[model samples]
Target: MKVTLERNHLLKSLGHVHRVVERRNTYPILANVLMSATGDGLDLRATDLDIEVTETVPAMTATPGTTTVPAHTLYEIVRKLSDGADVVLETDGNDQMLISSGRSRFHLACLNPDGFPDLKSGAFTHTFAIKVQTLKDLIERTQFAISNEETRYYLNGIFVHTVDGPDGVVMRAVATDGHRLARVEAEAPQGSAGMPGIIIPRKTVAEVLKLLDGVEDEVKVELSDTKIRFTLGGVILLSKLIEGSFPDYERVTPKNNDKALVVDRDSLARAVDRVSTIASERGGKAVKLALTPGQLELSVTNPDHGTANEELAVEFDLEGFEIGFNARYLLEIIAQIRTENATFMFNDAGSPTLVREDGETKALFVLMPMRV
Candidate 1:
């Protein structure tokens, strides 16, 4: 097998799919990327059995064939090559891959292409087109709240489905990590109505986001009961669906949190950032937000590293109240706020609280308060 591709083109293509390759692996072939030549380009593919990504890059095909070579090794070698230099790759009958650029050359051990798992492209029970920006916004608004705990596999993804929204039916995405929750709504794409919700695993969400990078064009989505495929421009991604149901997130969100406080998102972020500096050293690492009628005082005490405080003038049209929260969790949800001002609705210190943009109801965040 042989192919000739520019250094930059090789690097660009590898950047899209390398993240799917696991660093440590049980299968030898899983560590390598499968390279095969098409009519005028090379197709690079990498997978960890659960998720697979494939991309096409322009290359001069010397001989159309396939071989699997170590993903990171090839990426590192191509990355260090002189910019724009042409790279030549060739493999022997034994699967040893030879890569050459100018005076530099490398021979990396390769695994047989047959062992590289085949990505079974399944039929789409339902297919649809979605704007790139809409998908990006949904992910950014909810990804921060995705649970990282593997044991609670059901909560480790962003739940996406159609719901009867305030403005008729709308597509919504929800994510929660037990401590905090984020929900974003978008006008459901035509034909996406009535589509049942699906929980997109965190890894797939991240990879799909990376694939969407640099692409403003509409992406084609095909989904089945067991798998989902994302097609955008020249890249394609296939992922196995998480085989469990997500938690009842709707029931967990508070319907009416009476205490309302409106504050500038940037101001809240900065105050949280500053106070967390001291909280980072304390047990439970909590931050206390004491809200008065017109002032919001943020404070954190370490008991070992003293305390930090910041006061922000806010539109707190409520009685005196206080809430304790983990400093990291508060900062994460606040960072997702894109608007100038944010609004918080609190039931009490012991109940779940809701947050949203001051004037927008499209996105909502819920956080469970901590006992500091």
Candidate 2:
């Protein structure tokens, strides 16, 4: 294979595909990226068994052929090259690939392209197109709540499905880590009415977000029972779905919490953060929220570090009640609120608390209280 491309184009294409390659791999071919040079362009593909990404870069092709080389090595070499330099790639019959740019040159061992594995995307049952901003919103709002525990494999991803919403059909994303839950929705795209629920793995979610960053174009989605494919311009990402079923998150959403407490989102977050400074990290950084008619007191106590306290004015309908929660969790939820004020609906000190933007219902959060 022989191809010559601009350094910037090569670096951008390599940046997109090299991330799929793991630093450590049991199989030799899995550690390399497959490069195919044709009259159309130069195609680069990399995979780590579970996920695969491919991108095409425009280049001057002298000899059309295919070969495989270390993904990260090539990416790093190209990244260090001077800007605007022309990069040349050539393969000899001796099973080696040569990379040259100005005064720099590297000869990397190559593997047979025939050995590269392919993740076959079977016939897709559903195909839909979603606005870039809408998809980005759904993911950013709920991705932080995805569980990292390996035992509950089903909770390691975001649950996505379409349902009949108040204003019509809407697509919703839900994620929970047992301690906290986030749910957000957007208007459903055309042809997504009866789509099956799917759990997109955390890694895939992250990759999709990167591809969507700063992009104004729409994303094309095609999915089957076990596989999902996302196409963004010249880049394609395919990932295997989690086979297990996600927990029934709707049942846990509290609906009867009546006591309303409204507080400035930024003010409450700062107060909680300040008071938790002396909180013991091993003790969950628990912050106590003592709500009175017109004021809220935030306090944290640690036997080893002493105590910290802060007060904030708040609007509460009920008399006196105190609740304990992880300060980190509280701040994370508050950061997602788009409005200036956040409303908390409390049932009791022991029950779960519901939080939302002052008057908006499109996004909601449920936080489990901790025992202080």
Candidate 3:
């Protein structure tokens, strides 16, 4: 088999498919990308058992055939080649693939494409289309809270479902890691109502985000009980869903936290970052926030690294309270707020604190307090 394609087009297609291939794999085929050249174009596919990505790029096909070669190696080779150079690919019956561009040539061992595994996508129960930017917003607002702990496998992904909202039905994404929780909602898209609540694995969510960048077109999503598929432009991604049940996240969201404190989002985030600088590694990175009627004091103390203190005038008129929080978690949650003011609703120093953008109900964050 022989195919000739522009170097830029080959590099772009390889970039899209090679990321799914792990650097090390137990199976040789899993480490390689399956390339099928037809009269129309060249198809590239790569998988790591759980997730698969495929794309087709236009090329001049002299002979039609299929083979598999190392995904990363092919990407690197094309990436280093001179721009605007034409690339030529050929496969021989001796299980060898040749890559040539400009004056450079590479010989890559080829695996029979017949042995490549296909992620069987059975009949899908639900299908929907959503704007790329809207879908990106839903993932970015909550993905940071996904758990990494292996024991509670359910919390390792974003829980996506449709729920009733004040105005109407809205699609919601919730993620929690026990210490912090993020919940964000958007207007439900057509054909999304009554859809199954599925947990998208962390890796798939990350890949979706990367693929969505700078995309102006809509994304087509198809899903079943066990699998999910996403199609954008010429690229397709399919992955297995997490099978465990996500906990009832609504129960953990604080409902009656009435002590309201509004502070400049930028100022609070900077203050938390500054004070935490002196926090020792042995002692957890905790910053104490002491709120008064009109002022807020942020302080951090470490026996090994001394102490830090800062004050900011805030819009707090309720009863004063002191709360401790993980510095890293606080900054992450604050960064999600798009408004100028970040409103914190606190029940007490021990209970979880609810935070949101001023006058915004679409996004909310809950943070557990730490003892300082």
Q: Count the backbone clashes (under 3 Å) in each candidate.
A: 0, 0, 0
Off by more than 4 A, model 1: 280-282
lDDT of 1 by residue, 12-33 (tens): 9998888899999999889899
Model 2 residue runs over 4 Å out of place are none
lDDT of 2 by residue, 114-183 (tens): 9999998888989999999999989999999999999999999999999998799999999999999999
lDDT of model 2 at position 257:
96
In model 3, the clashing pairs are none
Model 2, C-alpha of 115: deviation from truth (Å): 0.9
Which structure is stronger by TM-score: 1 or 2? 2
Candidate 3 per-residue lDDT, tens place, 36-140, comes to 999889999999989999999999999999999999989999999999899999998738999998789999999888899999989999999999988999999
Clashing pairs in 2: none
lDDT of 1 at 67: 85
